[model samples]
Target: MELLKLHLIALFLLPTSTLGFNKCNFPAIFNFGDSNSDTGGLSAAFGQAPPPNGATFFHSPSGRYCDGRLLIDFIAESVGLPYLDAFLDSMGTNFRHGCNFATAGSTIRRQNTTIWQSGYSPISLDVQYLQFSDFITRSQNFREKGVFQNLFPEEDYFSRALYTFDIGQNDLTAGYKLNMSTEEVKAYVPDVLGQLSHVIKLIYGQGGRTVWVHNTGPVGCLPYVMDRFLVTAAQIDKHGCSSPYNDVSQYFNLKLRELVLQLREELPAAAITYVDVYAVKYSLISQAKKLGFENPFVACCGHGGKYNYNRFIKCGSKTVVNGTETVLAVSCKDPSTRISWDGTHFTEAANRWIFDQVVGGAFSDPPVSLKFACNKMNTSQK
Candidate 1:
């Protein structure tokens, strides 16, 4: 309880950016990934979807899966930029440097099926990178013509852009839910990583040198997975992350870190940083009582008792009528206070806290050591 108070105090004081740290080296950020890092690009595409999650904050679903902002938003702000608008948003095109290509429920592959069959655009990461290449080409041509109408000139804009990739949760979760054995799942992991590597290479080819690659988090701890897989509630731990799932996540992260090092050696010009978001996140949840959080596994959304979820239904949908199998969840009274708003994503407030830690360099080894390679370009121009 004493610790929970400290955590709460941190929350209250967190927004002021008073934690005293070096400012972000990158001038702008370009984000790509699934719901974790997405800024509502997917939600907007699903137009006419009744007041989505962002309804509470924006008075409508502003494309973000959360009530407001995700990790990318805070990261942008930390560096003195507005939250990056999704690439598809009209206002998003106005942002100078960054654009979010991440769509909710997206993956690196075409065929991997997950819990939410509402699979994002048929385009995989490979196609997404191709799209990115096209955008870069367009931006360059626009700049050469002196049409500074876009956010910034091509040189300064793309050079300073920080590329962030946080995805793969859905792919892993999908495999597990299908009852695949550990070895079978492990076999598929390499393919996923290979796709990630290909994307990284594509970005490097596009003159993006500052890459922040995020590995999978503790997928086992998610409420839906825990409730479905764990035999006893006691197995859910203090923070609600399932132990077995976390174990697999750790294994993945370990391998991912090694992979990042290999990628760095391959693309020496880029500033590559490996992020262990899971470790930092786990720390906060480990002492949840001190952080003023109860039932980390229990989603703020969902209906019904216990899990408040069904494999067949989604949140906010009228799945049940007349006490039948409805959406099976209810959003919390104040989503801002809850760590998690749904079975798979964190609330906006929670996301901010996580960003604060990462920006403060909590998740990286040897701290935030990546320098802006673009700085050299800037000096050369002078």
Candidate 2:
């Protein structure tokens, strides 16, 4: 454990692009998470996302809440894989590279609980695992029937794949909405991490070896949170975010980092790394002007509020606002110059920038790029 800690510390000090590091490539990628990383899982299941959500890049809603691709989409592209299909969209879907099981409102724990009543409930991390297990079973059956014909001739695909997790934000946000105090909301961290650890262990037990876990981002900086909780001047930070909410997010990220380290010691053969999404996102906010963001505090799409966000009006709703009778939640002329999209999600431009930094290694623990970490496992085995 001490050696591992020293190794990680040393890696952190190295340049983002360390010379001699191999680029990691994987046969498949299975992602599990909430909206931040969700591609189309929720859309496939609930049909809630539509139109202008994907207008910026896709020119239409492709199930992504953002105006274009997500971090996971960029990650897949970086690893040389096609866009992953949603796990729920199984009909005629190709699982050659893998499928995404992340839904917009999924939590680390089950979503049917009373606490998640106000949250979106399509499938949670627990349910995602069940779906993955079922996929494995189906794949095995197809192999026996010679349906795969050698495409997936062996079970090695599962062992050699990359398992990515980006969950828990919903858990934290939902609890906060229930009026839980900082301490009260934080009390759920251990259980959330415990459940996450269980999922990682389960994946390892079933042959997954490389896992990349993303710590939650700066939830307070999100337009939705700021508009909802920090409307008053005293409650807002200099960046127009909710200071208390950001503090809670930091606390969660700290605990998650510790959990990742512990997992490294416990699962010696598995390559588990934590991604500091909070720092990456906060940088965009703090350096908004330098990053080309004309406005970081306001949503790129929404209506009827100071932050360009209205909870009741939403990003695509049509409603009356302050005597304006047919006001619709409209998008900005140029989403590329903004950070937040629809009050909660990031714009595609923002996601692209974040992905570039993430793949560069600075945001990851062990200080190695994600591609390097994935390649390290294969190189060690060889």
- Best prediction by TM-score: 2
Which regions of candidate 1 are displaced past 4 Å? 1-25, 48-52, 90-92, 112-121, 143-148, 151-153, 228-239, 311-313, 319-329, 369-382
| Native-referenced Cα lDDT, model 1 | 0.66
Residues 1-382 of candidate 2: C-alpha lDDT, one tens digit per residue: 3324534564656544456665666888989998887878877776748667999878887888899999999988888988887887744567778878898878988755542357566588888999898888887789889796444324677887889999988888878777888799999889988999998898888888889989999888888887776556786777767788888899999898888877877887888877888888987888899767878878888986777988877777766778786638888999999998998899999999888877756667766777667643222100
Model 1: per-residue lDDT, tens digit, 1-382?
4434534543443323323433346656778788887776666666422334775656776677677777777767666777777766654365566677887777777654432464545545776677677767776777788786566434666755788889877667657767886566777877888888888988888678777777777777676676666546565555556776777777777777777777867876876777778866776567655667666656676665465555445456665577786444457777755676676778777787777666643455324423322221111000
In model 2, the Cα lDDT at residue 88 comes to 79
| Cα-based lDDT at residue 30, candidate 1 | 79
Which ten-residue region of model 2 has the weakest summed lDDT? 373-382
Distance (Å) between predicted and true CA of 99, model 2?
0.9
Candidate 2 residue runs with Cα over 4 Å from true position: 1-12, 15-22, 112-117, 148-154, 318-327, 375-382
